[model samples]
Target: MHSQYKSRQGHTTLGNTKTTVAAPSWISDFKEITKMRLSISVVFSSLVGYLLGVDVIDFKILGLLALGGYFMVGASNGFNQIIEKDLDALMERTKNRPVPSGRMSVNTAFIISSIFTVLGIIILYSINKQTAMFGAISIFLYTCAYTPLKTKTPLAVFVGAIPGAIPFMLGWVAATDDFGIEPGTLFALQFFWQFPHFWAIGWFLYEDYKKAGFFMLPTGKQDKGTAVQTIMYTIWTILISIIPVFGFTGTLQLSIVAAILVFAVGIWMLYYAIRLFKLMSVKAARQLMIVSVSYITLVQIIYVVDKFIR
Candidate 1:
């Protein structure tokens, strides 16, 4: 639900035109508005960071972190839809969202988001001040900065990556209650990974995006420059992912064995990136997108497993 769907006036889910073929129920609408699954994935990233930083798990902290992270991301998504309801209405993939499709009022969405913002901050504050600060900043940067920049410039991806990258490091801060090279390393890994992941998504949806005036590609089109940057970022992502093996990342240590495993996935992702560069087709981009998800998820799992066994 990073940047999702649009509207068709005078409709209640069109069945999601019902992608259920039956108008989405209120329960379904709630899920759609909050972008529930996407929010959960982001929460999982924060938990992974917490695991890397903590020597012993604290269930209280873990539960709080998950709740706070979900509220924060869900709120961001809700506000994003409110702002882009019209733009979302213009895209086929987004047209069924509640706000733009007349299933919910804008004011209602705003209230829910505002409540989430307050509740998310409070929950994070219960953990520690540093965690709370980062949570607020993530929300502000996403909704205030990144959300608006989507249609203004392709560099919106750069801006968006800021909030997108925070959950990983935020968990570290929650665990260690410190900001240092350890969390910085985690942030850098996620930060660079987003470029290729998001770009591939942009490539395949370039046409749909243009309908809403979105400039997702670096050059604003499917071209050599975009492909080259994809490869470049993929390389950067690989470099950062393996850096923990050097043992300079403090608490965020990666064993040589784990680093090898991480490198293998990075190369796997890189191959797809190169294919995208050579082929420059939507199909190639789609393949890269799928591999990138696996690459990131696998590398993180390796880090967490290495942390426990090493």
Candidate 2:
């Protein structure tokens, strides 16, 4: 489902000497390896972190984080591809990745990943040591631990959430130069959200992932246990999203109205998760995916609005 390939237009006529005018395979290969959508989503979180953290919005620092975070995330993904090349080949969705498709050499991919990782860390270091450290830790955990553990256990999603949530926290640290309630709050927000988001994807692509030997769900099979757990996490996500309303999480305070709005969105998302638990159908998973996406975007927007309003 991930690596989608479409056939070219009409076949050449017999005796036609026209060669297909296509770009270099390497160009396509890079795109496949980078996974543009995923890299963009990762960088979006980094940008959100930067926006939330900076008291005085500095476009220059924001630019640096965006570019640097992209490379950092891309590097992690590239290395992940290399590690999972074998398994990826087994999955229809992943079989066309750069390494798996033979469009890029493994050495080439590794070199590119190394360059990006080093450059990303250096750029983050310019912002602050904490930012750089978090970036480094994210890449390390994602690549060294989470990537390899995918096939072994579903708990890997839990482990993966640690690195996954770092971008938002990284933003706060970049601005404050220290980790505190603000960064902790942002971290918690993203941390809990990942569970439902990923589980939805896992549910939708359960068959595809299983083909690749990935145990992405807690129950391995898409069952009530897994769906109920997904619903529980979504409930937790909703609870954490509105916690700032209680006026206890330092400067990040959400008003009653904002909390209610956020809670409504959470409940909306949880509806699908609960449905998935009860019906255990792909339709429920699809609905949850839509709701999960809406949940994250709305939650972040609410956070930004609450910060200015409250």
TM-score of each: 0.93, 0.91
Candidate 2 lands at a TM-score of: 0.91
Model 1 pairs whose backbones collide? 5-94, 6-88, 6-89, 6-94, 6-95, 7-89, 14-17, 14-18, 15-18, 18-21
| Model 2 misplacement above 4 A | 1-27
User: Against the true structure, candidate 2 has what lDDT?
Assistant: 0.84
lDDT string, candidate 1, 120-176, tens digits: 999999999999999999999999999999999999999999999999999999998
Displacement of residue 115 (Cα, Å) in model 2 is: 0.9
Stretches of candidate 1 exceeding 4 Å from the true structure: 1-24
Instruction: Give, for candidate 1, the lowest lDDT window spanning 10 residues.
Output: 1-10
Error of 1 at 290 (Å): 1.0
TM-score of 1: 0.93
